[model samples]
Every structure is written in structure tokens, then in C-alpha cells.
Target: MESIWVGERVRVRGIEPEESELLMEFDQDSTFMRNNDRLHPPRSKAGYRHYLESGVGTPNDDEFGAGIESLADRRLVGWFGTNGIDKNSGVFSYGIAIGTDFQRRGYASETIVLLLRYMFGERRFQKCDVEVYAYNTASLNLHQKLGFVEEGRRRRSQYFAGEYHDVVLMGMTIEEYAAAYSLGTVESS
Candidate 1:
């Protein structure tokens, strides 16, 4: 059943039970959690097991999740998913969390490109939207590098790390994706 979404350096597939321990590392990373605007304590192995068993990475009605596996070592590097899918509007929002060790390796870029292919090419979605905390300059830069335009910002809306910060809103349309990656310019691997 089409389980894997292949990219050049990484492939995304369903999260596995055995990888529960690895998944916990994301929660353990205080910086990663803060960037993603999360504050929950780390989940136990059993909790992770329960989460995987709950079919998180499996395709659902409106949203879906998947684990990013690096091709170099076939290790689960991170995860991403779509939420707030609007069928009528043909718009969707997504989030991603890459392990600290896996950051700044172009993995996030390729993963997002792969997801754009699925959402815009396969599902025929019109636009993809994302919100990044203002302090996450890396993410904001990555989004712009990938051709996502800064639509606006919610000033001082998100409170964390002892102060409030703006929520940077970004979006990419299907036309923009086609232009950026025309003829599959983004090399695989």
C-alpha cells in the first residue's frame, strides 16, 4: 500500500513501534520543543508505543503523519504532518520536527519538497500554509528559500520562553511549487 514517500536524501514512511525510543528524543530536546511551540514532558516508551499504534503516521480522513528516514543510514530523522486541511478551499497547514542531530543537513528542505509534491501534485491542493515562531529564524529562512512568501505576522501572539513572540505566517501556492521545482530540479539524494 504505497507506504513510503521518497525524496533524494530522505524518505518518509509510517512511524514504527521499534522507533519509539528514537521518537522520544524529539520530546527530550528543549530547543526543538520550543521552536515547535511545545511544552509537554517527554513521553515514555509505552506512550510512544500507544501513539504509534494509534495510527498517527497512517493516512486519515483530513490529516496525515509520517516519519522522515535518512537514506544514508536508514534512521528515522524526524517527522512531519498535515493538519487543518480544507477540501473546499484546497488549502492545508503542516508542521515538521527534525531531530537536533539531523538539523541543517538539507533534510528539511527535501522533505518539504516531497510533501509539496504529494499535496499539490497528487492531491491537487492549491496552497500550503505554515506558521513559524519569530525566533525560529532558520525555519523562516528555509521557508523563504523554498519559495514560500511571508504572508503576514501575528505580533506578540505566542507566549513562550519567558516572553511573547510574533507568529510568522508563510504560504506557497501550487504555481510557486511548479516554478521552484520545475522539471524536478530538486535533485534526489
Candidate 2:
């Protein structure tokens, strides 16, 4: 199968050490952190450099971590990470974080499509799952729009912003992905 990571507006590529400062800047944004990863405190720029140098943002056999860049200007806009829950069983999960400036511009959606195409179409993963915090309406809506069903919810499981919030568990099987994003070649059966 042909590997295609570039979408109409964005492309996936290895994260560079110099981009650590950009990522650290995103981590410092409270609004972005609150929705994406509120629990972990933002790391220092030097810490981020060390983290990236350790290969935390590169694809490996068990998982993948990459930078999302704009196809137009090639500027880094976000980050994406994915890993197998059970590689042998074809189960996996992925998450993304687009910079505040990049939000609402379709980069997140296209990045997801590119990731899904790679995971489901090329890698042949059977299922993909994700957990969205209840307060993140945009994410919930986006996942729903992308055809990920709300499989269940974990109530009051995550505490952030001085309140406990529900964790919405969503998933999509290969069949559902094929049906929703039928590229005319995906197997529907």
C-alpha cells in the first residue's frame, strides 16, 4: 500500500529539535493546555529540546509522533501522536494538538484524515479509539463529524479547571471508517 501523509492543507513529518521552542509555546497556552493536556504542566524550552532530542516526536514500530506542517508555507502548526493498543489485534489510538492560531482552519480535520488514511488504509488497523474531555465541545463535534461513534463516557474522571469532567470515549472500526470515508477503494465488506 502506498503511504500518503500529506493532505490538501497539511502534511506530517518528523519533528525537528529546533521546533521544540514552538511546542513549548503551545504548551504554555493555558487555553490549549486546558483542553488538550491540562494535567501535565508545560515544560521549559530546554526541557522540550531534551524531550525532542530523545526521539519523542518520531514514528517507531510501536507508536508514532510527528509534526503537522502547513503545505502552503511549511510552518509547523501542531503535533500528533498515535500508538497501538494491541498491534497484533489491529487496535490503535491517536491524539492531536493544533496551535491556537491554527485552530478553526481545518488543519486538525485534515491532519486526522491523513492519519486515519495511513492507519486504516495503509497500516490496515481495524479500529481507532480516542477519549475527549466533556468540556471540549469542538473536539467532540469534530470526532462525531469524522464518524467516530460515542461508545461510552467515563463520568467525573478527569479533574481540571477546578471541576471534574466526563471523558467521552469514541471509536471507529475499519468498516465504519471505510463507509464514512469511502475513497472508492476501501473495502466496505
TM agreement with the true structure for every prediction: 0.91, 0.90
The lDDT leader among the candidates is 1
For model 1, residues 63-175, the per-residue Cα lDDT tens digits are 89888999998999999989989999999999999999899998999999988887887787899999999889999999999999999999999877689889999999999
Local accuracy of candidate 2 as per-residue lDDT tens digits, 56-137? 7566654888999998889999988995468788989988999998898889998888788778877778899999998899
Q: What clash count goes with each model?
A: 2, 0
Candidate 1 at 162: error in angstroms? 1.7
Cα shift from native, residue 64, model 1 (Å): 0.4
Please give the RMSD to the true structure for each candidate, in Å. 3.8, 3.6
TM-score of 2: 0.90
